[model samples]
Target: MFSYNVNEEIQLRLLELRHTDELFALTDGNREQLRQWLPWVDGTVDTEHTKRFIQSTLAAFAGNNGIQAGIFYKGNMAGCVGLHGIDWGNRKTSIGYWLGAEYQGHGIMTNACGTLVNYVFSELNLNRVEIRAAEFNTRSRAIPERLGFVQEGKIRQAEWLADRYVDHIVYGMLREDWSMNGQASNRFEVETDE
Candidate 1:
């Protein structure tokens, strides 16, 4: 239900099944690119399946468990990011994202993550956010690092990806850290420059 601009070229909009066709098309177009880091997508996405998934996510959002967004760049579907498996009383949530291969290396994801994290802390009133990435996923890990998230350590054999169990690096950021030092608007200090 929320909408925000990640940058001049990109818009991040909260998602629902009403755009199932759009979701399916984007996911289908980048199946192989996604499979390298995300094994959860089995390359079988279609409009019907996307609708069901979006419905499930919408239900989660209603129950205060999650929010999922479809990333749009210049009016075209570009990728996705989600704050899921929420624990409101604990004031914590996990962040996850995937960009089509075409969208990688453009800093789009870093900007999107920063904006979403800001929204979660300010608008959703969350205290802490966690981001986990497979050990080999440099692109994924960079999002949290560039946002000033603290590296908490790694969980050995934490996630199953590419048909094998892999270690996962966990990163966390508290609301205080973000508000005090991580805001993107402060021209004197950049989050990544630290």
Candidate 2:
């Protein structure tokens, strides 16, 4: 049970079976908007599907591969942020995240992402962390950019979002770069129960 208080208003907690209902409702309510960016939105047609997703995230945490955490804003589920997986041999991992449309413009995703980036460099002792966003998704790309990640490269036709192929812009932050940037110091009071 990992939990981190990003601020007085935002908290990140490891996803659990109990979160299925709220998670499903959040996704369902935001289906049309989320469908534009996330490919799995259509596949998540029921709470059972959301349950399986949570189950997999738990398994990933148990296996020490990575984690998927739900973002809580003002005590309500707002969205999710997570690592895709970790390549331990290479000391690197990539992050993915999304926020319900109603939660946008509040900087919730950016702060949540910063916390994960800090965890990756300090707690996980990983050398590099990457965040990839669809080339046209300025909101998504802004998170990494706001946190000082470098624009590493781009992969054409990297993802199939709905009916079309979308290019991906890769952003990367290395442990050394993070440390040198001074933002490495946790800006928010962090609490973790594992």
Candidate 3:
């Protein structure tokens, strides 16, 4: 298992089968709010769905393609952040994340994202990381903006959220840019279950 301590109050842990119940509860409880920006909320109708999702993430990690980690706040699961998939040939990846409605306004996603960005550059040696958010999702867009990511462009009708199509605003960060911005410092301790 891979776990990272983001701070005294926040931690990131690889999602596992054991987390299915907790994860499902969180999602089920926040269905309406999460459905606003996340398209998968409707698909995840039970713990079984959450289990399958975790299984896939574990497979991705095993293949060195990407990771999906649960964000923990004070020892409780709060949300998730992850790399959609790694393009090893291009040395790049995209990040995706969401938090429970109750976890909003705490800067948890921002810190988790920053930590993941650092890990991408320093540990994975990835040259670039991209984040795409719905054009109207200010909260999601703010994470990359706060982390100094450059606005690359916008994709028209990139995603269909429930009944409507939403444009996506793309943000990208390069390794050189992250280093030059003085964000290379490792602010968290990483632990691997051995």
Candidate 4:
């Protein structure tokens, strides 16, 4: 398991099967709001669905393909953030994340993402990290922008929401950019369970 102490108020932990119930409830409660930007909302029917998702992420972790972590706010499961998958040969990865509705505006996701970006560049030694969000979802898109990602372009009708298709705005960050930004104040520690 991988964990990060982003700060005193925000922490991240590997999403495990045991967290299914709470994660499910969090998502379910924020379903309408989340469904607008997330494609998998409709498929997440219950705790069982959450468990399967966690299991797949565990497999991905074991295979060194990806990592999915839960965002814990003040010791409670508040959201999730992760690398959807990494292209080892290219040293690139795409990040995906979502926070509970009530947890928004708390700066949790931003700190969590900053920590993950730090991990990607400093620990994983990856070259590029990408974040894609619906064009209309300003809040989601703002994360990558605030993290100093460059806006690459937009893909028209790139993703389908429940009612319609939405354009996707792509943002990318390079290892070079991170190094010159001065990281002395925002480094995070990664702890793994044996």
lDDT of 4 by residue, 30-108 (tens): 9998888898999999889999999999999999999999999899999999998999999999999999877877677
Work out candidate 3's RMSD over C-alphas. Answer: 4.8
Q: What's the ranking of the predictions by lDDT, best on top?
A: 3, 2, 4, 1
Runs off by more than 4 Å, candidate 4: 183-194
By summed lDDT, which 10 consecutive residues of candidate 2 come out lowest?
185-194
lDDT of 2 by residue, 1-194 (tens): 68999888999999999999999999999999889889999999999999999999999999999999999999999999999999999999999999998888777888899899888988899999999999998889888888889999999999999899999999999999988988688553333210
Candidate 3 vs. true structure, TM-score: 0.95
| Superior by TM-score: candidate 1 or candidate 2 | 2
Superposed by TM-score, candidate 4 places the C-alpha of residue 132 at a distance from the truth, in angstroms, of: 0.6
In order, candidate lDDTs are 0.81, 0.90, 0.91, 0.87
Per-residue lDDT of 132 in model 3:
100
Worst 10 residues of 3 by lDDT: 185-194
Per-residue alpha-carbon lDDT of candidate 1 for residues 27-133, written as tens digits (9 for 90 to 100): 88888878877876784556777888888888988887888898887888789888978887899999999888777767778878888888888888989999999
Instruction: TM-score each candidate.
Output: 0.91, 0.95, 0.95, 0.94
